[model samples]
Target: MNTRILKSCLLGAMLVLGGCASGLTGETYSRDEARAPQTVRMGTVESVRLVQIEGTKTNIGTGAGAVVGGVAGSSIGGGRGSIITGVLGAVAGGMAGAAAEEGITRNQGIEITVREDGGQTRAYVQEVDPNMSFAPGERVRVLTVNGTSRVSK
Candidate 1:
């Protein structure tokens, strides 16, 4: 009876965990509002100024969490505890890897000032592809990137 109950509980827990990690969160944004051009090749950096340095630091919390959880779990019953702990470790490791990758990347933005020929003046790089070629003294058209923003010229 106890074994049966344990099995059922484990199965239920597995199902619940699976559902949570399946990206079931209902969140959607319209393409018009979230779509941006994929790339920009000819735009020049208008106003070359370092806005701010953004840094992503890799955190070993996930892996560390997994290792600790595994060790603790392994010390439990003998077989059952070990199995449960291993699964928990795996999940922790996955989370840690994802966080590390996210933290390792960095992005910096610059305000671009564009000047077209014949005195046509317009600025569109700020928040968009401010880094796109504007020459502070040149001209360009920028495009968006998957919703972020980028140069189009």
Candidate 2:
């Protein structure tokens, strides 16, 4: 049997196994649970907009993919052919890994427009959590403590 299929399998396996984790807790700060003065603004939701939130990008995916692809590609041929295949495989694997990582690490956010009780309007783009949601005219509290803000019902 030719090594093409084997190489493909190896590359696929590497991509699946060698990936990085991006921790997005949606909280601006951590470790300090100490009580801080929070500016609570009671408001009603005027609008809710769906948005895309960028998490992060580390070289782990691309780097791991390239290494595995190069090794897999090298096994299929010899001398110059092997080298060329290795380079090609590395490029493909790296690209795939990066795309996969980006897809996996993506976060969902919502742009919430609220009209305060004092006749002022504010918009907050916050990470979407399954436990939290808002609708038009729903009474909610806007909490901002130490520059970090969140809307809670």
Candidate 3:
């Protein structure tokens, strides 16, 4: 097959094997954690963006399905049948792959909370607009000169 396809397969395999674990925990934090007081603006998630996302899976299924479909379709007839079979196989394979991937990933909703300069907290039901942005909490960075500040997340 093509070298690109081989590389993609290898890369996908590696990514699939490497699990994702980065997420926030519900554990509460105290003001002492920051050490200093911080002033900032913030927004709350009035609602979660509940998207019925499919999980991610390997592309092997799609490739296999396409190959099988093409072979079966081609075998059914001779010249025209072969072409039709190949096309059908490719489409079927793609759909199968996507579905499989979605099942594996089981992607779900996201609650985006943004903070602004003011203390006023606004709750949005929909996904936050990229331009109309808010900070998650007060931006309290640890610096050699500035030091740390208390910020709520």
Candidate 4:
């Protein structure tokens, strides 16, 4: 019974840990809203700034790490010492796992400023693409929908 439970827990942890890693890049999309018909605005690229997109922490790392750490720490000693080590190991593992998830999932982004067809200007920040480079004064199409936007040539 104990062995089966341990195996199941480890499997679950591994799956959740996998989710902590980042997915595909290139095109940018909003996480808070669904896709709608985008409104396009013709513009010229005014500026582009390099930036970092922070990763999310959903506790999968902490939970997976605690489970794995406790399992490993259980083999240390016999009584009080074993219990203390297991607890400490679990706590340390959780923190390390969370950091690992953050490091893995963090993204590189760019903040692009555009001068629209009219006198108005707007700025958008999105994930950077190696294939897409926006030069100052270059023409672009600003597509926006549901409070999210992207700039493309």
Q: Write the per-residue lDDT of candidate 4 for residues 61-129, one digit (tens) a residue.
A: 777778767766665787998898789878877887687667667889888899999878988877788
Off by over 4 Å in 4: 1-35
Residue 19 alpha-carbon offset, candidate 4, angstroms: 3.0
Best by lDDT: 4
lDDT of 3 by residue, 1-153 (tens): 434553565456335533531211122233453454443433343323434434445665565545545544555566887788768866875666556545655544334433334554433222223333324443422111133221234
* Local accuracy by lDDT, each model: 0.43, 0.74, 0.43, 0.76
Ranking by TM-score: 4, 2, 3, 1
Ordered from best to worst lDDT, the candidate numbers read 4, 2, 1, 3
User: How do all models score by TM-score?
Assistant: 0.33, 0.71, 0.33, 0.78
Predicted structure 1: lDDT? 0.43
Find the 10 residues in a row with the least total lDDT in model 2.
Answer: 21-30
User: Which lDDT tens digits does candidate 1 get at residues 1-153?
Assistant: 544544554454334333332110112223553553454333433464534333333334344434444444455566776688767755765475445434433334455544434454334423224233334544455444554444444
Each candidate structure's count of clashing pairs = 13, 0, 14, 0
Residue 60 in model 1: lDDT: 42
Clashes of 4: 0
Better of 1 and 4 by TM-score: 4
